[model samples]
Target: VLDPNSFTGQEFMMWTVAVYGDGWLNFWKELKPAIKTVAPGWSEGWVKFTTNEAPLMVGYATSDLYFDEKSSDKSFIPSEGGYIYIEGASIVAKKEIKDGAKLFIDYILEEKFQRLMAEKNYMLPVTDIKLGDEYNRVPTSTKLVKVKTKDLEKIEEYKKELIKLLKK
Candidate 1:
């Protein structure tokens, strides 16, 4: 059971973690059991559905260290895996590209444009262009081990296969 005494006046707690693409669903399964084992009184309704009556806990959709330090206690596991998602870009046939597409690609690669992309689009830049503290929605440090580009490419390939299988 959760030690209510441990959280008498505490607002929240943080835990250290790492998220991997394959492990995302597993994390939720594990979290539910952990929460239950520690806090048996925690109603299933409270944790499942999101409604007006439910106390909202905005779980950060980003990497680990994001919420740990903000928690009431420092009880978190250090995860070794990195999150992986297969995202693809496609140009629709309906959309006509009057100008050259190479120029658009070059602009996207430039640091200046990437910084602006992060600020305006909020998508993580694929380049090393530092979107300073002001624009960093996710608080990641140099310490965060980055997932290799090759790994991401493999994940993308796997995702394509999975999609093809589903279509059949």
Candidate 2:
């Protein structure tokens, strides 16, 4: 288990701010009491969660897809909102193999590729690929929260504040 006073929590707070925007610090403060044991990272946390050492642990909603037997675990999308970490494929500037990179990107965006990724990687499809029944069990909120690119400019400052707050 990670020490609650450790920098891990502070780093998580920083990530929360980067993805969920402002007010995460206040939420963390409020929720701290309920958080009994903290793990050094997600892998450790996942072990704790699976072994029932922790009643609640942070992870992807689609995590159930990786399990052999579908767990009763449910993902709750808070009425306030939830954060989505978006992943993208980008072609680096001045790349030697630009055509290959473009082809890869195009292939990735295809429905078949998206479906395969959603199934194998246990992640949400970026394209309009049909999802499996497992995905239906994951609760989705209409009010998903996102940090604007403009707000991202202050991420470093937010990290500093998060560290200070966690240290307190």
Compose the digit string of candidate 2's lDDT tens values, residues 20-110.
5567668767766687676877678878888899997766667666565556776575565666656788987773766888899999999
lDDT of 1 at 91: 44
lDDT of 1: 0.39
Q: In candidate 1, what are the lDDT values of residues 1-168, reduced to their tens digit?
A: 222212210111111112344553344444443342223222433243233343333222232223344544222212442232323444446567645565776776789877776666555777887665644335433333344455445544543443333233
Cα deviation at 119, candidate 2, in Å, is: 1.2
Local error of candidate 2 at residue 27 (angstroms): 2.4
Q: Estimate each model's TM-score.
A: 0.34, 0.72
Point out where model 1 deviates above 4 Å. Answer: 1-78, 86-99, 135-137, 141-168
How much lDDT does each candidate structure score? 0.39, 0.67
Clash list (residue pairs), candidate 1: 12-72, 13-71, 13-72, 14-71, 15-68
